[model samples]
Target: MNNNLPEKQPPEKTDWLLFPQEISRDDIEKEIKKTPIAIQKILNYYLLTDFESKYEEIHLFLKHFNENKKIPIAKINNPVIYKIIKTARSIQRQIHKLMGLLRFREIEGGYLYASFTSDFNIIGPLSLHFSRRFPEEKLIIHDTKRRKALFVEKGKLYEVVSLNTLPSDTDEESFFRQLWQRYHQNISITERENKKLQRQNIPLKFQHWLTEFKGSCALPQLDGNRENI
Candidate 1:
């Protein structure tokens, strides 16, 4: 071995030796400003085209906003975010609508099935009501919009079945509906004739759920149906 041994190879160089240090925000802003006009336009447009872009805009806006003091509408130019906001508002409007619109047909296998054409988020609240009311029944509400099904099976809740799955009720369900209609009709006073009060009691959209609604003859069998209880 050589006497000096080449100074023990001077320890291997590390990435930190050659790596560039982080630039100051001012320097970064200056460099970003120097970026081509077309490139800036492309970056701005990137914030416009997609949902992820909105997240990116939010991230960049929050990141740069303190020092930058102003975020150009151009930097965060997302019409999609507006669409999402509008959709969210629309969903809020439809919460009561879904509450009214959802039709749960009790089936033979101790299951409650319904098809909902709304956001999956709405199902969380809906499930709370249904599961509380029908704790014993296995419930499934499929959202056609998301192509996913929310199943409350044996008291557990989650999504299932990406593919479409249709549900069916028993033939006895029709006979039971007739009996319920008769009961409803029997309870109604023909002499009272408060059409306005009746409408207020049950809205037109919920007409389908009413067993006595002129054309809906399929009243569920109320007798043994209480077995679930």
Candidate 2:
């Protein structure tokens, strides 16, 4: 007797709601339908060239999916597509904000050490910022979220092992951060503060980045005062 596991189905396609508002569901479907088969051929060639050594069947399946499925262009009208696009855009914005707010510190041996979560692909914009801000210092931005890092040494950028490999963890930079936080905290006045202006100054999503944001850090060491909490 032979027992075989049931075949697993492909995961559902991503929703289009998350996509840019300009790209509609009908537009997407229409584009897909109108595109020549040559596009798939080109895609197959590139995929096989890139990934065939590890997964030969990947190209075959992609080709098959391309031929078999009807991907509508205007996925914007589709609720599922809309949701996917919307979520993707939100994630992109968060990553962009994080990169913009990333603080870089110069370390020993001309090495600049900066760290952040790498949930989204924020490295590209980050490199742009560092190139503009610090033309002299070679740097690395270790993104803990994805356990990956980018090294910008002598103006060249490349991916490297995570900074978790570094000798010190958060302990390495916690002291300076605490001092900086204290200085900022001390200057704030409760009497003249405008809650609306505060919200406008720092959006709720990015409040996690603010040292004054209550309960941001779970650890007592990183957590600030709890007057509001």
- Candidate 1: regions farther than 4 A off: 1-84, 119-125, 162-167, 178-229
Off by over 4 Å in 2: 1-75, 165-179, 192-229
* Worst window of 10 by summed lDDT in candidate 2: 47-56
Cα-based lDDT for every prediction:
0.55, 0.53
Best by TM-score: 2
Superposed Cα deviation of residue 119, candidate 1 (Å): 6.8
TM-scores for every predicted model: 0.44, 0.48
Please write out the lDDT profile of model 1 over residues 1-229, one tens digit for every residue.
6676554333542222233444354554454455456434333333322243344333343334333435553344444334434444555555666676576667767667776554324666677667776777888876665666778865678777564545466656556657667777778878987889877766675554444674554454445655554
Question: Over all chains combined, what TM-score does candidate 2 have?
Answer: 0.48
Candidate 2 lDDT, 28-62, residue by residue in tens: 33443454674433232222122212122322233
